[model samples]
Structures are given as structure tokens and as C-alpha cells.
Target: MKILFVCLGNICRSPVLEAVLRAHAEKAGLDWEIASCGTGDWHLGHGADPRSRASAQRRGYSLAAHRARQLCAADFRRYDWLLAADRSNLAEIVRRRPADATARVALALAHAGLPQPLDVPDPYYGNAEGFEAVVDLAEAIARAIVARDAE
Candidate 1:
């Protein structure tokens, strides 16, 4: 499976999700392709946020090689899944979706079976605790994705 995680700026949530999910996918011995990008280009070519990197590092996931990029039209056809961090970004992704695009787009949290108001809350403006929370959600979503693939 090929997957892409999307966020507003690509420095926090999406990259975290990409790393966590990549680790989980590897552990499950799945030959999956995974990547991440932002709906906005503000952080393009920048590394993952320090806080996000530190959080994932503590959990044994590396964000060292992550570089932010903006979502492009080609992404719609390249990934099997295009997961958004929140509703706003998801809306942007949907609006940019091409008619022939094949990716299954959805909120990362809801796709993980989380309840209403599904969103992988942005940790940009928050503190360490917020980044930690993103890690928690990333792990859960990663596990869920692995399980679903197993099925």
C-alpha cells in the first residue's frame, strides 16, 4: 500500500504520522510506500518541527530525513490513501482532488476509528505535551492501519 499524510504546514502532524506509520508498517513486514506533505507551502523544504522530531525520537521513530513539501496534483494519483490531519486541510485536499484521482482521502483520526470531530489536532502552537499527544495519536493510527492491512 502507498500512503501520504497531509497537514497544513508539514512540519508537525503529517511528518509524525508518516514516520510512525512507516515504522509500524515495517514491523508488520508490509511492503508499503509512505510519505507526507502539506496543503500549504510555508514549510516547504524545511525539516520536521523540532518538537515533533523530539517526540517521535522518544518513541523510537526518526524524523531526521523528513522534508516538508506541498501537496501536488500528482499526489492524488500516486497514493492509495491520503490522510489529512484536520478537517480544514482535508477540505483543501478534496478541493484539489482531480476527477481521475484514486486515493482514498479521509481524516487520520476517523480512519483510525476515533469518534466525532475527528482530527489529529495540530501541535504547532502548543507545547511538548501537544507533540506527545500527536505521537500517541500517530501510534494508534499506525497500529490501526497495520491491522486493517492485515485484514
Candidate 2:
């Protein structure tokens, strides 16, 4: 299976999710493909935000190889699932999604079985603790996805 994570910009949240999920899936012996992108063109081709990288690395998940990319038409059909970091990104993705697209889309937190307030908060403008929260959340989500896939 293939999965794609989406956020406002590719440099922060989505990259963290991508790396965490990949590590979890690998550890669980799942062969799923994972990637991330943004709804906006900003930061395209740039490396993941430094704070996100550092935060994830502290948790033993590496964002070292992540590069920012914008959501493209092809992504819809390329991934088996397209997960949004929050409601707004989810809305934008659904709005921009092609009618013929084949991917299933949902909020990442919700898909991971988290309760209401299903959005994964953006940590780009926040303090170090915020990035840390994102990493924490990423680990939880990675385990959840791995669990679901295992079943």
C-alpha cells in the first residue's frame, strides 16, 4: 500500500509523519510506501524544517531525507491513501482533488483513532515544545497505523 501525508507546508508536520510512519511500518514488517507533501507551493524543494528534523531525531525518527513538495494532480492516483494534517488541509485537498482520482482521503489524527479535534496542530510558528508535541503525536500515529495495517 501507498500513503501520502499533507500539511500546509511540506517542511514540518507532514515530513515528521512520513518519517515516523515509515519507521513504524518497517519495524512492523509492513512494505507500505509513504510520502508527504503540501497544499501550497511555498517551500517546495526545500528540506524539512530544521526544528522538525531535530525534534524527530530526538525520538529516533529521522527526517533527514525529506524534501518539501507541493500536492499535485498525480498524487491523487498515485497513493492509496492521502491523509491531511488538519481539517483545513483536508478541505483544500478534497476541493482540489480530481474527480477521477482513486485515493481515499481523511484527517491523519482521525484515521489514527484519535477523538474529536482531529487536526494535527501546525508547529512551525510555535516553541520547541510544539515541535516536540508533533513528534510525540507522530509516534502515536505511526503505532496506530502499524497496528491497523497489521490487522
Candidate 3:
């Protein structure tokens, strides 16, 4: 399965989801292709935010090699799933999806059976605690994705 995570900026939430889910996918022996992108292009080509990287690191997850990229039309055709961090981003993705696209786009948090269609709060302008919260959410969503793939 191919999965893409999307956020306003690729530096925080989406990268965390990609890293966390990739680890879960690997451990489950699932050959899932996982990547992340942003709705905005501001952070294109930059690595994940240091705070996000550190939060993932604390949990033994790595965002070291993650580079920010903006979502494009081609991605709608390339991935099986496009998981958005928040409602606005999801709406933007839906608006940009090609007519012939096959990707299933939705909020990443919902896949985890969390609050129905909840937005994984953006941690970019907050403190370390915010990033930590994102890690927690990412881990849960990763496990959920693996479980779904297993089924």
C-alpha cells in the first residue's frame, strides 16, 4: 500500500506521521510506501522541524532524512491513501485531487478511531509539549494503520 501524509507545512505533523507509520509498517512486514507533504510550499526542501525530530527521537522514531515537499497533482495518482493532519488541509487535498485519481483522502486521526475526524493539532508555533502531543497522536495513528493493513 502507498500512503501519503499531508499537513499545512511538512515540517511537523505530517513528517511525524510518516516516520511513525513507516516504522510500524516495517515491523509488521508490510511493504507499504509511506511519504509526507505539505499543502503549503514554505518549507519545501527543508528537514522536519528540530522540535518534531527531537520528539520523535525520544520515542526512538527518526525524522532525520525527512525533507519537506508540497503536495502535487501527481501524488493523488501515486498514493493509495492521502492522510491529512487537519480539516483544512484535507479540504485542500480534496480540491486538488485529479479527476482520475485513486487515492482515498481523509484525516489521519480518524483512521486511529479517535474522535471522529479530529485534527491532529499543529505544533509548529507551540512548545516542546506540543510536539510531544503530536508524537503521541502519530504513534496511535501508526498502530491503527498497521492494524488496518493487516485486516
Query: Which ten residues in a row are the worst by lDDT in model 3?
Result: 108-117
Tens digits of per-residue lDDT, candidate 2, 46-138, equal 999999999988989888788899999999999999999999999999999998899999999888887555888999889999999988888
C-alpha lDDT values of all predictions: 0.93, 0.92, 0.92
Compute the lDDT for candidate 2.
0.92
How many clashing pairs does model 3 include? 0
The clash numbers for all candidates, in the given order, read 0, 0, 0
| Pairs of colliding residues, candidate 3 | none
lDDT of 2 at 80: 94
The TM-scores, one per candidate, come to 0.97, 0.97, 0.96
lDDT, candidate 3, at 113: 72
Cα lDDT, model 1, residue 26: 91
Given candidate 3, what's the lDDT at residue 100?
A: 91
Tens digit of lDDT per residue, candidate 3, span 61-104? Answer: 99999999999999989999999999999999989988999899
